[model samples]
Target: MRLNIKITFFFLFITKVCLAQDWMQTPIPGIGNIEFPSDPEIFDQNGVLIYKLENDDAFYLVSIAQTDPSYNAEIEANLEEYYEGQLEGVEEASGGTVTFKQDIGIDGVSAIDARISGVANPELPSLLFKRFVYVNSFNVSAEFRPKKTDELEFTALKDQFFNSLQLDVSALGSSIVVDEVNGEKDAFKKGYEIGYVIGRIAFWVFLVIIAILVFYFIIRLLRPKKKKEPKATASKPVTKQKIECTNCGKSNSTEAKYCSQCGYTLPRD
Candidate 1:
């Protein structure tokens, strides 16, 4: 069961690589109309179309797909579980280490906010965030990354991408597509924004720890240790010796005037 769930999420993740652009309102014909920051790289996979917009510093991608009506019965049976499965699927697909998710709404359409980090892809930036919107007949999903280094600027851009999403069901009756989006940018919830910030901070902190370890090891290898010198031992002092008197052949101390055995006077040296 767990293996099946992971496969499902991996499929969803690789299939969905589709985000924001200009004020230009372009119609998607049978699908609907969408506003883009600029022209995106469009791909047609069978019936589903994926759009990707990116530059040196940021990326935005989105895709919409038709969902089976039969699944709707299951969704109704357990809506929370259904959403949780989707969230877990994405998390597994990205090979993410940490994930933060919340229930969100897009102009009444129910959606999930999925902010993830530590994807297997090291090339992927630390601040990768996305949203998935599920409609009765279709699924609309989008990813947003910012070019600006400033946290505030990145947050602003992220807000622009989510708020600009407009789902048009009228184009194909049950199908979903971008409608039109502009004006008073809706801000991302404070908690969700903080989650993104924390992910980035965590990534940098990990790098710093690695750097400190490397530096410490390098210093240990290069620096030399001092060898201790052996200490010198003290010698004992010499004591006075007794002298023999030539006149009486009596042994006496060098400082004594006479020997106790013969009472002879000791000569002064």
Candidate 2:
């Protein structure tokens, strides 16, 4: 009886291990494979590829779409704006308020991670965790909506779903490049491109002008000032020397003819 019990326990343990490692790999062309906890329903809607999986506790979704060729540079330059738009769209669709948001990167690719709470639903109020990744010309999204936010299993599943996404860098190297000359160009789009370029150039020129003005003012402030010199004054005139009269023994001017007190004539030199 004891031997039979030991064998049954061993078999059960082996089965549990196999089930734990039963993640399914779903391949996405031009991107990479994502490991789903179970087989997900895949479909295409309006040129966007979508994969969905649902269980009693939570729902999982993955979406992939190719971006318009003309807006590649704009999206790359303004990644934050693109992310904000995506978050806003999610909020509007689910009627949820974004509770947490973070900027992240996967395999050197920029991404945004956000959480939404207070989603309005008649059946159950749901919590959503979403990740938006930009891979070259493709926009990849992964989402998890759990029925119960406080459950440990749901949290672990959320982490597993997000982490299982693998991007193949080798496939991304041969990216699709659209030749604009061969395609029809809209006049409005062309004008917008020209205006955007002009705006960028004008912005840089303004910044350079501001920098030069600031440097000039700083130089003026730090430079030493020159000192002023004192003015010259006029000199006083010298007085003539006086002479002594011999007879009166009195002093008189050098040009005097005689002494005034004695009435004697002055001797000529």
Q: Report, for every candidate in turn, its global Cα lDDT versus the true structure.
A: 0.63, 0.76
Q: For candidate 2, write residues 209-235 as lDDT tens digits.
A: 655655566566667987888888888
Q: What is candidate 1's CA lDDT for residue 145?
A: 62
Candidate 1 on 151-245: residue-level lDDT in tens? 88777777776677776545545543332111111122244356557865765575566556555665665679779988888988887788998
Write down the worst ten-residue block by lDDT for model 1. Answer: 179-188
Q: In model 2, which runs have C-alpha deviations exceeding 4 angstroms?
A: 1-16, 123-125, 173-269
lDDT score, residue 24, model 2?
62
Q: Residue pairs in steric clash, candidate 1? A: 18-61, 18-62, 19-60, 19-61, 19-62, 20-37, 21-36, 21-37, 22-36, 22-37
lDDT computed for candidate 1: 0.63
Candidate 1 Cα misplacement greater than 4 A, ranges: 1-22, 26-34, 170-269
Instruction: Count the clashes in each prediction.
Output: 10, 0
